[model samples]
Target chain A: MALSHDEVLHLAKLSKLTLSSEEVLHFADQLTPVVDYFRELNEIDTSNVPETSQTTGLVDVLRTDEVDASWVLSQEEALSQALKTHNGYFVVPAIFTRTS
Target chain B: MNIPLSISEVQNDLVQKKYSCVNLVEHYLSEINTQNKTLNAFLTVTDEYAYTKAKELDRVITDNPHAIKEFPLLGMVVSIKDIYLTKGIRTTAASKVLESFVPQYSSTVVERLESAGAIIIGKTNCDAWAHGASGENSDFGATKNPWNTEFVPGGSSSGSAVSVASGLSFASMGTDTGGSIRLPASFTNVVGFKPTYGVVPRYGVISMASSLDSMGHFTKTVEDSEKIFAVTRGVDGRDSTVVNHSYKAVSPTQKFRIGMPKEYFAKGLSPEIEQKVRAAAQEFEKMGIELVEVSLPHTKYAISVYYIVQPAEVSSNLGRFDGIRFGNNRDSFGEEAKRRIMLGTYVLSSGYYDAYYGKAMKVRSLVIKDFDDAFSSVDAILAPVSPSLPFKIGEKSDDPLQMYLADIYTVAANLAGIPGLALPAGFSESGLPIGFQLLGKRFSEPTLFELGKKYQAVTDWHTKKPS
Candidate 1:
């Protein structure tokens, strides 16, 4: 089944990506076949099968709560790669735009 | 000085004082200067850093010859895939999103390799976000196959394979999420070994698919692969998935039972690849090893299952690239990355989750079980790395599904979390490299490497270089 343009846009929205109208159509065209290809999984009977979140059987692998200095990035290093930062905190556009 | 073939030769020459460490670094850097223009392999060449490292090593060689043994990788030059973060170096992952991003810390693998005295020549190019099989998806440009420039060097470990194949570096660090390392290694005729998942810690490496990604490398010889593996594998405390298991060298006199998965050799595999891989299996038979014909029934569903599971993880892993921390906003992602993200979102979306992501996971269990059953009978499974030989650069770029299909034989190992070693089998009639992979049970790298070493012992395929 081909993904409609609106469906593609919904995916883009959920993914936090802004796509052009052309990209919406393009993605719809491209992703339709891939999604259809994924339908092949329905043919298999996996009712009793359990989900595998990870290959390694290790679970709840925990370390001591103490901080190790070697891996700790200083405040300067932490904010180093940000495009916008102020007073040691990353700056971003307003999460809520007010409209009245 | 001519480029040495293996790490042992480099170590021997360094000890013999045939050439200084600086000469070796200079030779490789010069080769990069000459070949990289056409091959488009290296994204960054660390001439200053390499020289500094080499000078420091030269001092050690001159004064503390006894301590030289401590540095197993002394005088060896290696390359890092752009996906691996090198401290203070720009690691792009071949995407414009992180184009100018300089990492503050190096990966565990990098830190270990450097400590073992490996001189990192540079960061090599790869598919953007490691989303594609062919290197054409790289944001910078496609990495050309060293054998035939018009043809592709299979990716997402494109430049890593090309670097080792063309002698630009002795070995290269790469990630194999879904045959990223093995496919390229097959295309370029290098030994690409993807250890079992969590064998090499994933900390400091750019995430593709969190669950599927396995850190691996490319080398000229199986023994060189073993040396690099020794330095890289271990728990680094950061990546919680890493298991603290040391490598055990296989006995030289050890015999083996190799499996040929019937499903892998079924229809759709290129006849030439089938013949070459069969010939490789025959080589094992000649070594007095048993070749059992095994069956993996769920093999047909591997590619479909991977598309679901890998993208689901990719979507989650890539969500961190929000421009606030490191890279540019979502717009900087290439077409392939965007497509994967969107696909991942669609699958993991509310109503469709169980149908797609949930189902893929269950099928993934079946795929893993197939390997478990097969391993009970045979020590390792030998199969073609790719269904076909390397095609021309522009051939599969237009079709994403066609490109994903190229990963059929390789994704199974990643899903099963098994160790796979891709060894050069022979050359095609057209002279492109052909390779076959040995898949062993989890943490069976020693057995796979032993098989690879035995194969390389009689066959000169690994010695043949691309002209």
Candidate 2:
């Protein structure tokens, strides 16, 4: 059940995080115990119990359509926290670069 | 004489004119100035706002002297946890990203407490983003346990517990996702109540885990805790999850059948805490309450189940803080919160979703069924809130697993979506405080409080003062 170094690295990359070498080593040690704990969940028999997506017994509470603008934040005030911007659009590095 | 009053004591005096709302608030303001030097409890103190509110209360009391007799906790002082929004006030959640940000709208709990006439003196410190079990995770600094400054106040509601225990305020509001409120209450020796999930609206809260995140309070006694719960418990349109019905109060059984889950006391528990829990239950027996033995085999897996379920929800709930719309200071979220977001996202991604989050939900169902079986035979379950008393400041900081283990007793209640109360059981041999929990059926808070108050009457443990 040991996690391979490549597996951990692949997981981090998919998560969009940049972990340092020191953190990798630290997480390598920490994730060992965590992975071992979850191994027990694999052994339980839950065939009789339906997998529950939510515990709330009620289905849904729908609100009627209404046009109420209370406690709303202005657009500029809200978007000001972005790290980068261009032409009033949020800017992030392209996920897949076009080969030219 | 600088005196700090409990909610009950203050309410009675206000009725007798022993002190006006203005006098009580000014006295507490001065106490904060003198005491906060050592007890790093408050994050932002609202001096002028509190004074003006007190003056207004004076006008109301004067105009209709007899007509103004309502839950006069109206004039009482309260502390707010940093995790809630405090419109036009600095609420950092102890994270550096929102250090200078003032939320445009206050959290519903904050707005509700104000309308009730309670003066909010300050917002207290907490673990950044309410992610860690210990206060060591705060971006600002760790809060010191009031009983012994050398030790840490258990968190992420560290300051809320300290302020109530050290007499800085009559009571304080806190959010408990897992053990946030209970752990600190246990460490600081105060009463912490986590009402049944959805009893208090989560609107405007900086949520950690939506389904499991519960908004609750901490106070000097079980009575004050109940009063606060009554004031804030109701439906709010602002929060989609808040329940719409008022629960009728249940008087806990005179011959209450208590459950002592052998699984809880099986292993890894401190002897001192074990003895106190057993002693507290024996006190219940003397009071003619029933004590029954119960088993919850699935209890051992709660921590594993919680870590997985919570982080998965956190992965979704915290998506708003992408260095864009929310947390303005992109780099200021503490390392712990960043680490969790990274870990949570990894588990919930396409490749590993079934292996982690899906399986955890299945296990959560088993945990809830275990509580359902145990509650059928007992009015409530009694167990030690923490395995032991408060540890030294750096004791569990480096090893995250040890810190996570401190939440074992408290997390199960959250997973089961029931109410749990942490009461001061007794003190450790070294004179530190230890706590035992009284967990009850869903919406059975009054049952737990009445039972806890009955125990407090016979034993003076709740009254012991910390130097």
Top of the candidates by TM-score? 1
DockQ of each: 0.86, 0.40
TM-score of chain A of 1: 0.88
Regions more than 4 Å wrong, model 1: A97-100
Regions of candidate 2 where Cα sits further than 4 Å from its true position: A2-9, A74-100, B2-5, B66-72, B251-254
Clashes of each: 0, 0
lDDT of each: 0.93, 0.80
Q: Which docking band does candidate 2 fall into?
A: acceptable
Candidate 2 lDDT, tens digit per residue, B1-467? 44433566676676677888888777877878988888888889999888888888877776766523464467768999998898878888888878776777788888888877788999999988888777879888898988899898899999888988887887899989889999999898888989898779999889898888889999877877887887787887878777866676764445678999998897889999999889989999998878888988888888888888887777676666656544563345566775676567756878777877777777788888888999998989998898878999999888777888888888988888889999888788787888889998888887898887887778877676677
- Name the best candidate (by DockQ): 1
- Shift of residue B30 alpha carbon in model 2, Å: 2.7
Q: Write the per-residue lDDT of candidate 2 for residues A1-100, one digit (tens) a residue.
A: 6656665677567554567777677776776676676777777776575554555565677776775677566666555555677777777656798899
